[model samples]
Target: MAPRHHEAIIVGAGFAGIGAAIQLKRMGIEDFVILEREDDLGGTWYVNHYPGLAVDVPTTTYSYFFEPNPNWSRLFSTGTEIKQYADDVADKYDVRRHIRFNTDVEGAHWDEEAALWRVALGGGQQLSTRFLFTATGFLSQPHTPDIPGIGDFEGTVVHTTDWADDFVADGRRIAIIGTGATAVQLIPELARTAADLTVYQRTPIWVVPKVDLKFGPRIRTLFDRIPLTQRAVRAVTDAIYAFMVDTAVLKHRYFRRFNIAAADLAKLHRFASIRDPELRRKLTPDYDFGCKRPTFSNSYYRTFTKPHVHLQADGIERVEPDGIVNADGSKTVIDTLVLATGFDLWEANFPAIEVIGREGRNLGKWWRETRFQAYQGVSMPYFPNYLSLASPYAFLGLNFFNTMEYQMHLMDRLFGEVRRRNATTFEVTEQANARYLDRMTEALGDSLFTLGNCASARSYYFNPAGEATLLRPMTTRRAVTEASQFPLSDYTFA
Candidate 1:
């Protein structure tokens, strides 16, 4: 028998899930259950434990707005530290008492008769709720490269998303598969310890030098002692970062010059740092800077200069008994394999969970039919009272947490409306959703995805139609402002 009833059911315990729970609690919505698959919290942070795993965005900018951690150890924080911070947030909010840890949400279907969502758990426990919130963020799942011989590889293999602490690569011959953002930050760190490192690169990446600096003792003490000073400092830093990616990336004079400087800096760093021109060429990318998520690495370029490190630009053909074989028939032997390939950002990493909305409509099929359109990336038309925290176009290159906070704010308003109207459900109208979807698609088409410059084969930013879905092309402020205004007029009340 399913544990039968609650006012709300939240699926994940990550940044987004926790955000929703905290906001709901503040709004006096206490009858809610946060279902976490793992025994602990920190959704993405808990999973990705690879070497040199850390936040790419600056520490001052990437945290919660309401409660900023003034005591971060570095400008760019590591995975462990961030995870601990998430755990801290959970503790501070007393959110753990409401969370059902180690409980995996199997599936959820809307029961038309009761007008509630029936949520199934792995342990055969069930919960019924008036609304379902999928805070299981878009990037929670690990995507493995579909190479033929992946299973046959005899050496120790690991994915950056599921890295185990017990695993070691200290003196082992390691071959890293993907050269995405994770690879950029980690390769350099691995070089300092690995016996021999070979990076199999399918495409070249535009490498930019990270100007990471540690805060002085005075600044740290000041920020810790005076909270307002920390908030002011964080605000200033956030604005500067927003300008760089949001406005600066689009500007002709400033951003273009910035790209040239980036390339030149890479060349200078490589020239002074790496002696091998061929290796440098393989490491350098041809696309415009910020064409993809620009990685932060001060030592990645320097890593190539190491005697034991090898960068193979040739495409991976297949996995041999010892290591990877390139398209050009060249092979490098390694005892350990690390896949730095990122997650399926579009699928929202909750594919295993079956979500059946009105008339038994599956969420996946609905997305597929509509090309992944959601009104402000939150509530879909048929799926009433459903909100995805970091859904389509909710991603801002500046800092993901700010976007998450904004979405949480939007959810707050929606829940408020639900309470005010004495309504059990509020579904987005199809006409409004379609109109917004068209506008968003037009906006994206004018942006970088269709700009003929981005060169990756496929990324999680797109829908099933190969159209970009995860990001809105507008500025961060505009996106947030637009998301904040929910058209109660567009929602039908019951």
Candidate 2:
């Protein structure tokens, strides 16, 4: 029997996929299906429900620009609220019907003769689509550190990505590995109830104070009644974050003082929260503030000052059945182990699933062998009719909505041209892709990742090649402008 087909197949029903679906519908191209691996559609929000999970980015700037939710309960909304926002946006845009939950896309190959993509699914099912989009986010794959004897451990082990609802941490001896953004949030929550909490930190993170204000009824009413009021708030929030990204990361050499000031703010926060000088020293990050992704929390720093909490910076030697052995030869027995090791960004998640483009050019293998890149962080050479929403240099600032909004503009422009020419296939020109990669490489030289000290930071921004290719080295305005105004000649349509 012939397999099911659609005009477009979007892998991953996350926000990015939903955005893409909305864009397609707006373009009068509605014959598409969103394939989601999970049973739900919230992507990271749906997948991650760890304790104390909340938006690190401000609620005003974190949501979709087109569909802003004025009813956020807090300045930094919780994971449940974010998931509900996703659902609301999906429903409002009428894209929910197009989504196929629990549908896993194993691989996809470009069919030259058929001029379409053949997507392979987990249960031996195949689907064909004229255009293929991979919206599997950067943080889609959860990374488990290869600690010795982790497999032989007798206790319950939980990765932050797969947190169990019934797993109780109250009064239980617990050890958590990693100090990334996720760990920063989880640690404080665990510290509150755990009888004994041990945090195994490889590198300390820079934390700033989170100004999380609960929204009052009046504020919500003001936002709902006067939509422009919410827009103004969003603009202000966007500007503040954009200033941080510009001065601290994008143009660190010219504005190093800003970076220093930000670091000092974190230091002041740390000093105020923790009383012990030794503990403060252990908690402080040695690297520059913008080197790694910084987070904001009111209670994270103070959580370490608790009597029962311990900070283990000596590194992990191995994990035994009962507990973990530190590199200093000390051991701590724990009943539950939590791994907040973050995601495998470059290795397992660049192209989350196998993608074989024209002439058997594998996307993942090509990126690793050569260099990680994508033209305008969307289109790639030899990948005809394909768009990768989570490609390299796509992320803009701390908020993902900035990137998504600009990419939506790019989609509008690119697909508008495709419709103008009445073309069935389109691919970015090799010269164009190469030129864009060169421009990105040159521009990154002035950025914090290149000029700033990041040796001890262990940032996910830097790919395995030691290149900070994750964020585009330009302002959000320029990104949107370029995305909308890039030359149509850059892509060949047929």
Candidate 3:
């Protein structure tokens, strides 16, 4: 049978895919399909429903600039609320009709002669399109630690991504691995109900106080009535976070004082919450601030003060059917083993799926063999008419919406040019990509990951090659301006 065809094929139906769809529609490109692996939309928000799940970033700055949700229940909205927001956006924008749930894209390749991309789906189906956009989020793939006995004696083993609805933690002894952002949220909730809770800490995270506030009916009504009021609030929150990212992470060498202040704030929060000095020391992060992603929570530190809760800094020696054995020959017997170990960002999730471009250049293989790069964090050299939303140097600030907004601007500019030229295909030139890569490299030289003491930080920011390519080293303002004003000659449209 002949392959189905469209003007564009979008992989993943998350916020990135949704934003891309909205942009395409604005460009008058309506014949596109969003292929989602899950049965529902919301991507990460849909996949993860673990306990204590909420946005660490404030809700005001976490949403699309144009589609602000004035009805957010709290400053840090719950995962369920975020998912609902995504659904509402889709419905409002009329993008839900373009989405195909439970459609898995296994691979895709460029057909040079045909001047189209042939996407291979599971179950041997194929789809062709003029453009392909992979919006599979950075943290889509979960990582399970390769412990020796994890597979054998696991009793009700659950990863955060695949949490079962009926799984109960009440009075059950639990051992959870990883102390990342997700674990920080989950540990406090489990401590409340578990008979015994042990957190296996591979690396301690920097956590500050979360000033989350519940919005009353009055505020919601005001926001709905006067949208500018909500925009003002968003602007304030955005400025504060932007300052933190610009000073602490991007310009660490010159603005080291801001990083020190942030570390002091976290330390003060820890000191006030945890009573035991030893436990406080154990929980303290050794690396510099902004090395890894930081989270905010009011209950996480205090949860450790509970008598039944234990923090095991000793590495995992192995796992037995009954419990986990510590490196110092200690054992913790538990009924439920939770793996909060975060996503596999570098190895498995760079491309997420197979992508073959011009001259048989494999996206994953090329990135691994050389370095991870993309022109303006969207376009690649050999990948014609393709955009990767989760590419390196794409993430701008603490808030992902900032990145998305800028990328949307980029798409608008790029697609506008294509429409102006009446071009059917577009590819970023190799020279332009190289120049952008060099500029990114030079800009990142001033970042905390490069200058600060991040050797001890097992940060996902640094890839296997020891380069911190995760974040773009620029202010959000600059990112937006560049996205809108990039040279048209950088991409060859034909």
TM-score between candidate 1 and the true structure: 0.93
Candidate 2 local lDDT, 1-494, one digit each (tens): 88788999999988899999999999998899999999999899999999999999989999998887888999999999999999999999999999898888899999999999999999999999999999998899999999899998899899999999888899999999999999989998898888999999999999999988898999999999999999999999999999999877898889999999999999999999988999999998889998999999888899988899999999999999999999999999999999999999988998999999999999999999989999999988989999999999999889888988999999999999999999999999999999999999998988899998898899999999899999998999999999999999999999
Better of 1 and 2 by lDDT: 2
Measured against the true structure, the TM-scores of the candidates, in listed sequence, are 0.93, 0.99, 0.99
1 or 2, greater by TM-score? 2
Q: Provide the overall lDDT of each model, using Cα atoms, as 2-decimal numbers.
A: 0.77, 0.93, 0.93
Model 1 Cα lDDT, one tens digit per residue, 314-343: 688889778888888887888999998888
What is the per-residue lDDT of model 3 for residues 1-494, given as tens digits with 9 covering 90 to 100?
A: 88999999999999999999999998899999999999999999999999999998889999999999999999999999999999999999999999999998999999999999999999999999999999998899999999888997658899999999898899999999999999999999999889999999988999999999999999999999999999999999999999999988888889999999999999999999988999999999999988989999899999989999999998889899889989999888988999999999999889999999999999999999999999999888999999999999998888788888999999999999988999989999999999999999999889898899898888999889999988888999999999999999999999
Ranking, lDDT, top scorer first: 3, 2, 1
Q: How many clashes show up per model?
A: 4, 0, 1
